[model samples]
Structure formats: structure tokens, C-alpha cells
Target: LRELKTKIACTIGPSSGDRGTISELINAGCRIFRINFSHGNLELWKEWTDNLRQVSSSLGVDCVLIADLRGRSIRFASPIDAKTYSAGQTFYIVRHDGREGEVPSVDSPEFFEAVSENDVLVSDDGRGLMRVLKRETDKIMVQALSKLTVRRGKSLVIRNKEIPIPNYLSHCVDQILDAVRLGTDYLGLSFVTSPRDILAVREFLDKNGSDIGLIAKIETISAVANVEEIAKVSDAVLVARGDLGMHFPLEEVPRLQERIVGTVTAIGKPVIVATQLLGSMISESVPSRSEIVDVMNCVVDGVDVLMLTGETAIGSYPVETVNWLRRIIETYEGDVRTRREISQDQLVDRFALGVVELAEALNAKIGIYTKRGNTARRISRFKPRTQVFAASNDPKTICRLMMLWGVEPIHVDSKEYDRGLEELEQKLKEQNLVKRGDTLILTYGLLDKPIHTIRIVQLIS
Candidate 1:
């Protein structure tokens, strides 16, 4: 099971929020746990973060928390009554109205300016689809394409339209501050369109004296159009197909994902493939064959993380979902094409490739000492055939590496090089992971520090 290179990340919500289930997820191969600030409040955030910390600590596993910030976006204000719309039905949208009937209002009055004829409008996160028929000064008329019960404050997304972002990004800024204060390992910024959006978040984090890793979610056409810039700024990229599908045709998502993943990987940044990996598992114990094929293809595409959102958050089979995901990953990971074929422009990436070749020559497990989790991620870009271990003083660093392909993260506190090695050997022995006469190719340093040499060792039992 430790040889399973691809990592699993599950969202924490109503179903998998408890310690027992969290521990089960860890055992079932979940390396990263996400807490969506969009759905829950600060109290829930505190509870979930504290619970995950407690559970991961109790289980002695390095599990990182992703505080997903819900950025400034559009949503329905509220409705007065139960309003359901079906295909071909015309509905009116007004600004600032919270009634269930009448024209449903949007949170932003700017939405009125953004709407145009023939534009696709998705309400409640794509549950309710509508096509704009006419745009009036105060109200926009849309014909529904699906049946959905509209509710108060349900998310409203205008496909491919540039929605105005609030000053300091509203709730997202507050959530970012909260996540920094809570000591989360990663911050997932929702609906990020450009490098400036990431810079804004970075400025806020800098002001607060926190250097939390930021993951830019590519879910909008603007984001996809500027993905290269976004990927350069972000610590990672999340291929958020749910909203991406809303912006573009659903059939285009797989190709878009491949292009995005390839582009990000070329720069040696992690890319996470998210949404509906095993959606059926939320209800049934088993996933469909098509879901298995999707997981297989994602692994083939060299995605750094495969995310399960509702599958673990509100699903009936949370643990099983993770287990099946891991199983599929392990099964297909070996069949993935060699990483050597991917071209590398960065010197660090070339060095990582060299490490892979050296490890293959020595028939050794690749070992690294990392801070800020960059070294492990760089090494993971090569997708080495040998198992990889990354040791870090920061539990967050260890946890963050959980999603990297072919990398096993271990938490170690020895600052000195010699002490670190002794502790590493002891951990290897205690975990029964390395045995007598096993070869290890080791490197030590932070990303800024130059590693002039790689140390090869034959463990003596």
C-alpha cells in the first residue's frame, strides 16, 4: 500500500467530518483533506480544522488541510416561495430581491450589466441552466434548460462572462485571513482568472505574515485563457471541471484538462484533477466502469492530485470512495508512460530527472530533505520508478507532499544533517519500509540552496 504513488485528497463535510471517518480516510489512503469555507462558517471551519489536526496527530499521519476560499462571486439573493423552473420556461432575474417568486435577484447588481442575449446562466452550481433571451435594465429574462428548485443564496454563474470581483475579494479575503490564522497548509482560491487575482491574495497573506501555499482553481474561460500566467503565480493548479464545464461545453473538459495539466506540469507545478472522480460512489458502494476509466486516464495524464469533493463530504460511502480511488490509481500508475518523455525547461526539473536516472541505476529509493515542499514536488515531476521519501521538519510540508506522485512524506525534526539521517534511518526501520542492504539515493537542501552532490547509501541492518 505504501508503494501506491498517486495520492488521494478528500473534502471534509457533513459525512466525513468525524474523527473516526477521518482516521478511516487516512487509513484508506487520503493524504490531503480539504475544508470548503464556501459551504461552512468560521465555527465549522475551526471545528473541522481542529478535528483534522487531532485525528491526523492521533493516527500519526501527515495529512494536510486545504482551506478552500469562496471568492467574491454571484449568487441568487433569495426567493419568497418554492420556485421551480423547467425547460423552455421563462424566468425573470432582478437585483437585490430575496423573494422566492417574482424575478429572482442576484447578489451583485453588476450581474445585470454582464448578462446579454444567448448567454448561458447557471444557477445553484449548474443544477439550474438557463439561456438569456433578453436583457433589460433591471431584469434579465432567461429560458430554463433544466428543472431545478431555486433557493436563497444559491450560487449563480454567468458562463464565460467577466463578473466583477469585489474589493479585497469579499468573503474570500476574510477566509484567507482565517485560514492563515488557523495554520492551514494550503489555500485554494476559487474562480481565479488571472495572475493579478493570485497577487492580491499573496499581498493579503504577506500583510498577515503567512506564506501559505495558494492553489489557483481553473474553472472559468478567463482562467483557462490565462492559465499559463495563473499557473506561474499559483503554488498549484486545480482543474475544476464542474464550473469549467459550466463555462464551456462539458465535452471539451477532458481535452481542456489534458492541455491544462500538460502546461502546468511543464513548469514543474502540481496540477489537481477535481470533481466527480467517483461521483456514483456517493450513493453506491461501487463506481461505474466509466468512472474507473476516468481515474485511469487522469493518472495517465500525470495529475498530481485526484480530488474527491462530495464523494467524501456528503457521500454514503466516503471511505470506500477513497479506497476505490487509491485502488484504481495503483492499478494504472504502473501503466503510465515514462516521465522522461516530458520536456523540462527548468534546471531544477532537469536535476530531478537526473536523480531519477541515478536512482534507477542504483536500484534505490529516492530520498529528499525538503522545506516548503518544493524539492519533493520537483522530484515527483519525473515520476521515478523507484519509491521516493521526503522528510521535513514541518508537518505541513510533509502533508503537502502527500499529493505528489511517487513521493512518501515523513515528518522529521532534526535540523542538523547527521541527526536527520539517524532519525530517517530509525523511521525507515521502525516502519518496516526499508530493510538490510537496501540502497538509497539521498539529497538534502532547500530549493534556494544548491545540492552539489547526491549521497548513495546501502543500509546495514
Candidate 2:
């Protein structure tokens, strides 16, 4: 796809676990595959990981696999579960004794003693909430202010809301290490709410001798409040809008996403916008128009990764969604023609620097002609304001250049027009690398290509 733009990450699950589907996802423009620890057992995860390895090897693609830890998930203990309720819904979730019928004793010493006053018990993935009101030897009263209806095996969140912790996340530190041990390139820690939590995870990874990258999921008030600190400590951060919106007010989610993204961008680390972008596509083959707008907003706000959660995990149209997203990102980014300068510093190569200076003197927009990706990196290091478009002969080179900042890449046939300057500009314009009335900076010329000049800059209109 010559018009491909934006970095895409798709979650790999039962629907996309096979080699064929995984490869399809890759072809559709998924650079990362995420394995969620919460859904399946370790054996299942191993099988999925094997499939990912096989696909990446055959395709020679930069596929980053992220292992998601299944952390602490507290749930209810029965059928007809009651979840978030009004101010006072006296509900009882009795522990099963294998009895056939009848509501078990709420007065049972065993069940009642497990609860205490002031315990913030949230059920059904934080949809149901309650606070302990009164405590006795065998029964405790609670005030239910959240809607909650739960069943056996469903999650219940009983946490100290006033505690100085981020959230009652899954206790999966060891599980995280398991994925790290599997040669997964990235570690996604769920429910990360503070800088300390991220630090603790990284320290654990380092202690285990794992070099995998860490991504902190921001989904709580504490995490959003302390986002500045978390961004500094995290290798990357995920603006997990799903639980985040549930945890806080809905009106505040958008602003929080923007705030976190902008802060992380300042630190020069990747920030991912995850969950529910194409949520409807889990069953449908395409995403909603609003979803497309959501993704475009992410790109405009400078998010490094646009993520797919359930859409690629259990979704029937996982591969289709990936392809759709790839097309949308490419289409939207192509319309953004304003030049964004990234830097003004000089590079290690004096010749490249001289060329850049000449391009500026010519008032041209600098385009680093590179096939190997080195020239792009060197130019980005200088952080010039000129929008950097790295034209390459290799598609992989273009994809890999994404790791650097502000370096957009375009792939072309190097041999077709290496001999003439006019052909190069024509090709550039045809590829939408530069538009009419736009200034251009050209970096081309290799001894092997029969040119000794260190390339020069020229204005294009």
C-alpha cells in the first residue's frame, strides 16, 4: 500500500490466532500483536505466541507482540448477582455450599465476615458499586449507589477507594514475566494508575533480566490525575478510554485523553489510544464513521499508536478492520499538508548538514532521500522544522522509520529516476510527498548511483 500511513496495533485472539489470519492482519498494516492475559490460560497464550512467531518470520515484518497481564479480578460468588444499585439496595451474594435451592444465609459467619464497613465493592467490571455501611459479627450493611447485576465468575472490584494506590488491578506481575520470557517485545500492564505502579512494573521486568518494553494502561482517576508523573516513568502509555470513562465522568474522558497524549508527546515517547475505536467491527465488517473521526482526532493530536481492542480480539472481521484502519489513516494523513518542523539542530554528518542549510537558504521543505533509513534518522536527530519525508525504495525501511520522530516515509523505485532531478520532483509530487507551491529539499546521490555531490535543496512550485 503506497499510501499507507499511521502505526496500527491489533490484538490477537481466538479469531486471529491462526497463521493465515495473523498474516492477513500484518498485511492489513498491523505492526503489533497483543495477547491479552485475562481471556485464556497460559497454554493457549503459548500457542498464539507460536503462531505470531511463525508469521513474523515468514513475512520478515517488524511485528511487536505485547503480553497483557491478567491482573487481580475480584468477582461475585453466585447467580442472579446484584451489581451497582441505588443509595440503598440490600443485596446478598451468598457463597455456594452446593445447595440445590433457596437463598443461602446472609447471616452466615463465613460470608459476612469477609466484608467490612467502608469497603468499596464494585462488580461487573466496575459497573456496579457499593460502600460498606454497617458491620456486625456475621452481617454487614452497605449502601449501593451503582447499578450492578452479577453472576458467578463475573468480576467484583472491592478496593480501598481512599487508599493511596492507583487501582485494584490484576495481580499479575509473575504472569507478565511469563509473556516477557516468551520473547514478546512489549509488556502491557493493565489498570496502571500512577507513576509508582509503572516504576514497580519496570523494576520487576529489569530484575527478571527482561529487555521487553513496558506500556502502562491509564484507566482511572488516579492515573489521569498523575498522568504527568506516569508519562515520565513509563516507556509508553495507553489512553485506555474504556474503563477510564467508567471510572470517571463521561464528559471528562475526551479531555483526559488529549491531556495525556500531549504530555507524553512532550516526553518524546509513544502514547497509544486504545479500546473501542472500532468496537462495533467486532461483529460487523466495517467501523462507524464516528470511529473514523476518533482515529483522525488521534492522529491530529499526535498519538503514536491507534489501537484495536475487541475489534481484533474476538471480532469476526479482525483482518478487515485492520485493513480498513490502514486505509483510513492513509487517506486522512494525506490531506494534512501543513509542514510541521521538528528540529533546528545539526546532524553528525557535515555533508547532510550543509545540504540542509542549503535547502533552508533556498527556503525549501527538506525531503531526506533515503532507502536504508539512516539518512532519515540522522535528519530527525537534528530536529528541523521542515516536514521530513523519507523517500525510500524499501517498504520495510519506510515502516521502520516510524520509530523516529517527525519522519514520514514514502516508497518509490530508486532506479527509475535517480539520474534526473526533474523526474525526482515529478515522482515526489505524484506520490503526494510534496504539493504545488510547496518548497522542497532533496537529499539524493550515492557514489554507487554515480553521483559525488552531497545532494542539494531546491524550491518546487
Candidate 3:
């Protein structure tokens, strides 16, 4: 099997939640499993995480678990039977209170207040489009612009509007702490609008003494406007094209994706392109040709990861979806020689750049011994053509490094730098990652010392 450079993230749900199915997904090249808190309760999430960890250990795969927080997003509070509306059909939406009502309702009072006459409401990421004809205190009359099926817990957004909802992180503090206790490697914060949003979560995690990485999902115009600062505060960035389409015109989504990916990449953080990468594969066996081109384009654009939301979460062919994604990413990496020109003024970043430059010039595989995975991330920011093998003594760091582009994370038992380097090289040779007579460049850092070391060596039998 060919190794993929661009990582694949699979969202865990009923369709692919079991241990056997998760094992198949890992084999199909999914390294990160996203547990969406919007859909399941804590009990269900615990089951999924337990199964995932067992399967990963059994398969000897270092998988990363992301607890995706449903932050301040509006959704249907009560279960609504699937209802279909045709174009030009009229309907009513009201605030979902305890009282029973005939009209469909949402859980957000802010959503009702922010909407007005002529304002458009979108559900399920543009599947359901309705225009507000009139509004009362708690109810709004809407006309469907296109045919759509409404279901329970479906997310709703006001087109081109940012609702003033309460802080979801504050509301879900217990859930976040529970996820941290469940050994989640990362936290995916949804609907983040500014760096302060990320900082709030970071502060909470710090207070709890958790080192979980934060992924900022850029889905709104405000987030796009503050993407640079957001990316700087975040451990990674996810370009949520689904909500972006709802917030902006469909025609501008591609440009927005490119701009966000470029900005995140330049900041030296992992950038993930998500939502509808393989939407057709939700029910179909094969992805559409355009989906193939879209994945290729993301690869060419130098994205660190490609994420599947509904495609794997609720799709019929979850494993096969991952298999196809892996194939597409591998094919693109083999045929393309794209590079991102990144400039960093920081001393560590400059040192990492020098390491990448040396490896490229020598046409050698790069080996890094990172304690917190910072060295690997800094090197990845340069987008080197040669392979990168990042070894970390910390298991969490090993799993977190899986999100970086072109990085193959390996866990070493040794904590000392010299021993860790030797163990990494031995494991690389044993796995046939490096063979005799091959040139290898090694690097590591010392926190106590101000300087980092880099050396080139030739493997010998």
C-alpha cells in the first residue's frame, strides 16, 4: 500500500462506530477520528472512544481522536419527522419552547431575533433554503426557494448574518472536561468568530491542565476576516465549506477556501479542508469526477488534511469512502510537485526552514525527534519534497503530529534526545522506511538550551 501524505479524518457515527468498522477505516488510511458532540450524548461518545482506542491499540496504529464541540450553532430542539417541501411552498418556523406547536421551530432565540423580512434561512448547510416573508415575535413565515427535507437536530443558519448567541463553551464546560478525560487528542471548536473564542477554550483547557490541541472551524465571514489571528491562536484550522456556502455566495466559496488554506499554511498550522469533499459518496459507491478534482485541488493547494463529515459519519460506504479518499490523495502526491513558499521570522522557524532546505538539497529523508511536535510542525510548514519521519516520546504528540502534511509520526520510548534519535533510526530501518546507503538528515531540540542540532548521516548495514 502506498503511503498518503495528506491525512484523512473520518467522523465517527452510527455508520462507522464499531470497533471492526473503525479498524477497517484505519486500514483505509484514516488516522484521525472526529467525534461530533452535536449528535451523540456523553455515554455514546465514551463508547465510541473506548472502541476506537482498543482498535487502534490492537492494530498498532497511533490514531488521533478529535472531540468536535457544537459551539453556538442553532439547531432544531425537538425531533421533527422528515418533512419535504417543494419550491414555492410556504411554511412557518417558530421558537422551540416547551409548548407544542404545529410549525417547525429552532432552539435559538438569537436566530429568531436576527432574522427579518426578506432574510434567507438555510438548513443542513444549504440543503433547505427558505426566504422570510414575515416575522412575529417568535414565529416567521417562510417560502421555500428549493425542494428540501427537514429533519430533527438539523443545523440552521441565517444567510449572511452572524447571530449573537451565548457562549457555547461556557454552556458545555462539563462535556469538554469529559472529553478531555476521555483522552481526546484535539478539540474542534465550531462557529469560532475570533481569536478570543479560541483563547477562551485554551484558558479552560489550561485551567484543567489538559494539553488537547484546538482546531478552529472557519465557517463564517467574521472567522474568515480574522483567520490569521485565529490560526495563530489555534493548533489547526478547518475550512468548513458547508457553512461558508451558507454565509457567502456559492461562487466565492472556492476563493475563500484557497485564502483560508493559504493563510493557515503560512502561519505554520495544520489546515484541514472539510465538508462535501465526497458528498456523492454518502449514498453512491464511487465519488463523482468533480469530487476527485476537488480533492486533487486541495492537495495541490497544500492542505494538511482532508476531512469527511457526512460522507463517513452517516454514509452507507464509510470504509470505502476512506479507501477512495486515500487513493485520491496518494495519486495526487505521486503526480504533483507543489510547494508553499512560507516565510517565518521566528528563530525556531528559521532553523526548521534550514533543516528542510538541507534535506531537499541532499534528496534525503528527514528525521525529527520532537517532544511536543513543534519541530515537526515547523519543518512541515516548509512543505518539503522528501519524506519526514517525526519521532516523539509523548504518545499524545505522536498522535497530534498525524495532522501535519507529509509527516509520518512514530512513537519512541526513549525521552532523552540521543537515545530517541537512535531508536527512531532503528525503527525506521526495521520498517524499511530507510535502508542501507540512504542519506538521512536528523534534527532535535533542547528546551534548556537555546540551540537546536541538525546532522546528516548515511545509513550503513
Candidate 4:
């Protein structure tokens, strides 16, 4: 598991929110902590963060937290009442007067746009399909299909096409701010359409001096067309297939995902295939064979992380899903591919790899002392299979560092730096992670950071 060092990330929600449960996730092999901003608020996020810190402290691991937000963008049915229109059905949409079956009345008279004969209007899939045969100045005459119930302000998206984003973006600024304040490790930009939108997110993050990384979710046809630009701004990319399947031909998603992976990997950024990865297994105790292959294929295709959606959050088999995901990540990490193709440009140039290189020569595990978590991520990027020990005074660094692959975080007070090989060997043995014959390599400094040429040491147990 220490060899490949590929990472696995899972969503956190009602099913796995407690300290013991989160520890179960870590034992199951989750490296990153994902919080869905679409569901919870600042109050909820604070509690989650506090619980995560507690678990991370006891485990001495890095756990990266990402907050995903849903903007003023449209959402379909609320699951309570769902309707579907048959393919090629004609329907009518007339403004309602406080009625459930009629078209949702909009605030502006201009909301109804010019419609052509045979135009198909779908709200929440084909559940509420309305066809326009005649267009009026204020409304359109159309045929209705399947007694469809279109709710108020439900977005009427034309099937099999792309629509420009509505002008509601300005209202979503506060949601973004809320995420930044929660100390999000990564921000998931929803409904990404072009390079401009990506830049908008970056500019917002930059102004506040919060360099939280961005993970662009490509879920629309427009996003797929503008992927290169999105990849450029994103630290990572998630091919969100749920909305993507609705916008594009569902059959085309597999090939499209391949394209996304290629583009992000070409530019030296991480990418993950998300949504429905383990959907079926959510109810069953074990994952289907097809799902297993689906995960391994992503690993071989150069995905840095694999994410679980309902499978690890709301699923009946949530814990099992995490365990299953961890097993696969560990299996792949044991192979050489996890670190073999790393790009120097992807890692920080100033961070010392020389000490790590020397450790490789002597076959030693590297120990680093730090105050912040950035240095460890830079080191892990090198893909060194060395046993990593980061002794930090701060518990947050230890917890955040636990999210990194292969790097194990340990906490030692400032006074403990005086301990030489005997102390190092004793600590390693006490942790029970290393044997008496194992060799330990250590490095650190007062300040001047990641570049502080890792002083090499040989600790024999």
C-alpha cells in the first residue's frame, strides 16, 4: 500500500459523521474528506470539521476537506413527486394561478420566450414534457404529456441541446464565501461553462488570500467543449456524470470521460471520475463485478483519486463501500505506476527531494518536521515509496497530512527535536509500524521551509 500511493476520496454525510465512523473510513482507506456544500451550511460544516480534527489527531493522518456548492442553478423535482414524459410527446405549458398541474408562473412576463412548432420543453427529465404548437406574445399553446406536474420556477431545459447559463450567477457569491470561510481544502465549481467562469472562481479565492484549490466539475456539454480552459484553472477535475448524462447522449459519457482524463493529465492536474461509481452497491453489501472493474480501470487510466457518491454517504452499504474503495487504492498503490509517471512540474521545485533520493540509496523511510501541511504534499508528489513520518507540533497539520498518500503524520513537541537515533528508533518501534531491523531517515529545520535541505539520518531499530 505504501508503494503506489494513489489516493481515494469519499463523501461525508449522515451515514458516516461520527468520530468512530470517520475512523472507520480512514481504516477503510479514505485519504480525502469531501463535504457537500449543496446540503449543509456553516453551522453544519463547523461540527463536521471539528469531528474530523478529532479523528485525525488520534490517527495521525492527513485528511483533505473539499466543500462542493450548488449555485442559483436550477434543480428539477424534489424526489417526492416525479413524472416522466415519453420520447417524442407533445405537451402544453401555460402559466399557473396557484395550481399544481399548470406551468410554474414566473415573476416576469418576458420569461416565456419565442417557441417554434414541435419544440419539446422538459422539466425534470421527461417527467414534465410540454410541446409548443403556437407561440403567443405572453404565453405558448402546447400539448401536455402524462399529466406532468411542472413546479414553480422549474428550469425548462430544451432536451438534446445546450443553454447559456442564466444571469443568476451574481446571487451565488455568498455561497462561495461561506465555503471559503469554512477552510475548504478544495472548492468544487459547479456548472462550469467556460474559461471565464473558472477565472471568476480563482479571482474570488485570490482576493481573500485563501489559495484553496479548485476542482472543476464538468457536467455539461458546454463544459466538455471548453475543457482545456477549465483544466488549466483546476487543481483537479471531476467528470460529474449525473447532469452530464442529462445534457449529452448518455452513451457518449464513457468516451467523454476518457477525453477529460487525457486533457487534465496532459496539463499535469489530477482528475477523478465521479457520480454513480458505486451506485448499485449502495444497497447491496458487496459491489457488483462491473463496478469493481470500473474502479480499477480508472486507476490504470491515471486518475489520482476515486470518489464515492451515494455509495459512501447515503447508501445502505456506506461503510462497506469505503472499505471496498480502500482495498482497491491500496492494491494499486502497491504497484509501481502510482509514482512512476510523476511530472517534476507538478511538484514544488524548492522542496528537497535530495534527502529522499539519498534515503532511496540507503533504503530508508524519510521523517519530516513541519508547521504547515504544504511541504508534505510536495514531498509526496515525488512518489517516493518511503515510509513517511511528519512530526509536527500542530494537530491540524497531522490531520491534514493524513490525507496525503503514503505520508504518515506524527506529532512531537518542540522539545523532542533533541532526540537522536535512539529516540527515533524508539518512536518508530512504539508506533509498531516498523520492525527492529527497519531503517529510519529523519530531516527538519527552524524555518526557511520545504527547501530546508533535509538533513539525512540513519536510525536502526
Best by TM-score: 3
lDDT string for model 2 (1-461, tens) is 55244478888887889999998888877777788876667788899999988898899765667887654433333454333346567754454555433332231233354567777766543456777787666445666776555554454444534223333333676687678668777778776666767777777777878656678788766777888888777666888786665566557778989888777665556678888888789889878989889877876665667888788888899988988888777766644322233445422344555655666566666665665555555454334445666666655555546644456655566643354334556677776767767767666545255442444444345
Taken over the whole model, the C-alpha lDDT of each candidate is 0.82, 0.65, 0.87, 0.65
Q: Order the candidates by TM-score, highest first — what do you get?
A: 3, 1, 4, 2
Q: What is the TM-score of each candidate against the true structure?
A: 0.92, 0.67, 0.96, 0.70
lDDT of 1 by residue, 137-169 (tens): 888888998887776646678877777665635
Q: Which run of 10 residues does model 2 get worst, by summed lDDT?
A: 100-109
Model 2 lDDT, residue 403, Cα:
46
- The TM-score of candidate 4 is 0.70
**349 Cα displacement, candidate 2 (Å):** 18
For each of the candidates, the C-alpha root-mean-square deviation to the true structure, in angstroms, is 2.5, 8.3, 1.7, 5.8
Model 4 per-residue lDDT tens digits across residues 117-157: 66665554334556667876655666664456554434455
Which segments of model 1 are wrong by more than 4 Å? Answer: 1-3, 79-84, 98-103, 123-127, 152-154, 166-171, 341-345, 445-449
Best by lDDT: 3
Candidate 2 deviant stretches above 4 angstroms: 72-170, 334-461
Give the distance in Å from residue 189's predicted Cα in candidate 2 to where it truly belongs: 1.9
Q: Is 3 or 4 the stronger prediction by TM-score?
A: 3
Error of 4 at 437 (Å): 4.8
Q: So what's the TM-score on candidate 1? A: 0.92
Candidate 4 ranges beyond 4 A from true positions: 1-4, 17-27, 40-62, 77-80, 84-162, 166-171, 180-184, 205-211, 225-232, 262-268, 335-405, 409-456
